[model samples]
Target chain A: MTSLTLNAIVSQMAAIEQFTNNILKILEQDARTTPAQIAVMTGRTEQEVKDQIAALEQKGIIKRYKTVIDWAKAGRERTYAFIDVKVTPSRGVGFDDVAERIYKYPEVQSVYLVSGEYDLRVVVAGTSLKEVSFFVSEKLATIDNVQATITHFVLKRYKEDFEIFEDTSEDRRLSVAP
Target chain B: MKPISHIAKTVPASGIRKFFDIVSQMDDVISLGVGEPDFVTPWRIREACIYSLEKGYTNYTSNYGLLELRKHISTYLNERWGLHYNPENQILVTVGVSEGLDLAMRAILNPGEEVLIPEPSYVSYKPCVLFAGGVPVPLGTTPESGFKVTPEQIAAAVTPRTKALLISYPSNPTGATISREELQAIVDVAREHDLFIISDEIYDRLTYEGHHTAVPELNGAYERTILLNGFSKAYAMTGWRIAYAASTPDVIEAMMKIHQYTMLCAPIMSQMAAIEAIKNCGRECDEMAEEYNRRRRLIVAGLNNIGLDCTIPGGAFYAFPSIKKTGLTSEEFSERLLFEEKVAVVPGNAFGECGEGYIRCSYATGIDQIKIALERMERFVENLGVEGRLKAAGRE
Candidate 1:
């Protein structure tokens, strides 16, 4: 069944039969947190917790789980960069494909299409910008779309992230009654 | 490939840069993206660069930077923000606040430690964190909320792994600022959580509404905070690329080691230019900021008159106006406007997902350019309305 209609969002029938929200939340944070543990915390049966995680995984919300590894100590100097560029013309053509090629360089960390003098500001680093530039000149520039490049090699790094943040009503953290 | 072993293969690129490239090719595009100051580098600052050349100061600075320049930074920070940064060790001169940010990310963030990002923010924060092998958690602050992240918001975003909470006021994209009371409460949360504060006050001097507030102004917050600032926006010297970060001796020592190897030094002449820029920060910063303020009001008022609703940006020279009426996503509106009308604007989604439905219009262009652009925009919108194009184009 596909959700063609918005009303199909939280189906009443789907809400019953072990697809409870509490089990999913528990699984999302710690998929290994036992159904029994979830039952203790969420007041759901162990069977229900197991069923919800299975359902949520099917929904693609509970993607594959992984552990965080500290690789900075594993003999690599992590480098960050912000390279501002002046982009060339890409009218009436598959410009994005060309842009993608330039961005695909192994040295490229990220490529942003920014406003100002630089058309494409890339974020990439290697052992050094020398390594970064080798990829830029040999790989990125050779990608056919890149016109002019100016590298603002990062002399230092301050911050980054990839998690979701939201504002809720009831203040979930405060209402948790910790 | 000099393959960066041990790092995650995937690093996210900012969606905004693509639009910037698109707008660059089109003629007559007046841009408000990029969060750059509209004014040219103050004459004093520019003259300083020329002066440095005349003096032939063309050698690399000491790894930490010119002693005189560091002194000026310490003095500037103390006078402006009432904070003390030891010139000898607590401060390390960087290429720009961009580099200062990178250094901090390198120094403090070990893999898997959480660094909380408050958005819509400068495009750099999240990418920098991820590259450092740290996990980035974003906190969304909306326009309805003046884009200010509250203490409660900070607390909710924290997990046990949360090593740092960020504060960027006179912010980019949103132009939202934090009140002292609100900041103090955030400081309290950091103390409770035992988290560090990464304070980005790059927009510190351009605050039009009132005096700027820093998380470092609070008692314990300064000790636990890494201060990042630069001459880019404030001094209108983005090209010169001189900025620095301030922290305790231990943290700075850690960062300086990374910086020395990463970038042996910022351009020698750029440091010379910064020495002059800092000494003349008083009038040089104010004159350009005042002009930016005038342009800021004009653009905001004009956008509103043209039927694009925009909130008053308290600081920075950008007015982010919602283009929902134009019935275009930030990209569609920006692209068509560039190709058809020749007006350049950055789509809001470039900053974060929340920035969708809006476009960042920089007031950095001349008053005449803004006025003409506004007139063209009014015509564009009116024409779209008459043709029933905007609404029909799937814009609500």
Candidate 2:
């Protein structure tokens, strides 16, 4: 009997989910940070950082280079939300087929499959919760495979991977409990 | 990426949203697609909001909302609309008519419950119903029965799991309202089935024919009905986001718990403005309604003149006309009219399946703009070249 090592099983799973988001963990961050700096942070070779980015790019995972705007400065300073959705596939269709149909909606910034009663989740932005609910129901729930949905509005986001690029170097104080 | 959550993955996109996005991209589009008041917030209401801000009253109130706002809502409903509610216990001020609809469903629905939703309704009802973990079983209505929810249709749609029957009069998309007599029949069916009623009366004050009746005021309904009304339509305060739900304490209490966890309360200023709206500006609200009625007549009469026979609406600011004679789908005709004629009316299908071969044209605009829209629509009709284009002329 052949035995698969733990690392081998993990690598196999990671390979499939690699498209979910590249594990560009510990990417160069310091404005003074570069491929050379990341190499120093992770104790990898300077050339290795460049090679990993190139590999990720070749695999079509690194889609584009983008800039982050401060949300307050961007005139979108209001509360942001994420709506968790569950769709009933139209016409006896399965989740994949129905999701494929709905994810194509313009208001949907992101889409995912979730655990529990609902099979899918969506991220959307709107001026207000009423606007968000309007989008989910009037827009998303009307689609096939959206049998039902439960929306968990973000109360406050303590962590956001793409934004809040602070390293916790400063003494951060909160008057109210986060 | 495992995507984000269950909700993001499952629900489909909204048709109205998709249409708005498309329309937003087009040049020279005059959209009657949006179902909101065109008038700005009345001066008295705006002054009231300013007064609240000047007084520096800008903190979150009780989860149910400011006590005075609720008291005003309670009194306003009773004094004007003939409905009764307890300020402290039976009312939950909400984000808008939109949130009140959601709160009603959230409070009522158990998982897998079915909501008997009437078709050609305001776009939000079905989705709001579904979001509360209820299934929306759409009961189709038509011009034949004045587009009101027929008692027979309600009986056919109800099942054991049917938790609520949603009733929206002076309905959006369809522009229909039920008579007091007609409502009594449906009320009988709802009582027999032990079903709850979620009556939406946002357009209650805009009626052209007669005064709107409050179902909750009817015999035995005050206990079961969750009546949702708002100042948006009446006061032209779309952005104010103040609406309230009047119901039994159990329902309002359940809604308040959810409202506290979620919304907290409606904007402090909006509630304050609403207090003045109910207290001071009754005539100002009616002036906007009267203007809409004028444009309603202009559009409906013009459409009839040009061969689109419409069910002249009794309340609300819309005219629903049949487009069958045009030989184009509601989507196609509206799209063509947008580009070629520079007029935008929402497709009937934007409302529901039964909304096919019809269109909802809001008269929420000036008479001059209504005139321009009508003339351009007449040209579009003449050019459709459908065999029955002239058939509509006879129906008029």
Alpha carbon lDDT of residue A27, candidate 2?
A: 35
Cα TM-score of candidate 2: 0.67
Q: State the lDDT of candidate 1 residue by residue for B1-396, as single tens digits.
A: 687654445765567656655655655455545456555677777788888889888888888988899999999889877888889998899998888888888888878999988877778788888888888898887778888887888889899889997668888877777778878888898999999888988888878776788778886787899999888888888778889899999999988999999898889888988888888667768767756765676677788878999888888777888889766788888777777777777777777778889888877766667778888888888877776764567765
Candidate 2 residue-wise lDDT, B1-396, digit = tens: 557766545765566665666666776555566567766677778887898899998998888888998998888888866876889899989999789889889988998999998888777777787777788999888898888888999999888899889998888877787788888888889998999999999898898776688889777688889999998888887778888899999999999888989898898988899999988888888666755664575577688888988986888888899999777898888778887887777888877899999988877765556667777888888777643555667752
Q: Give the C-alpha lDDT of model 2.
A: 0.76
Alpha-carbon runs more than 4 Å astray in model 2: A1-178, B4-7, B386-396
DockQ of each: 0.01, 0.01
Per-model TM values vs. the true structure: 0.66, 0.67
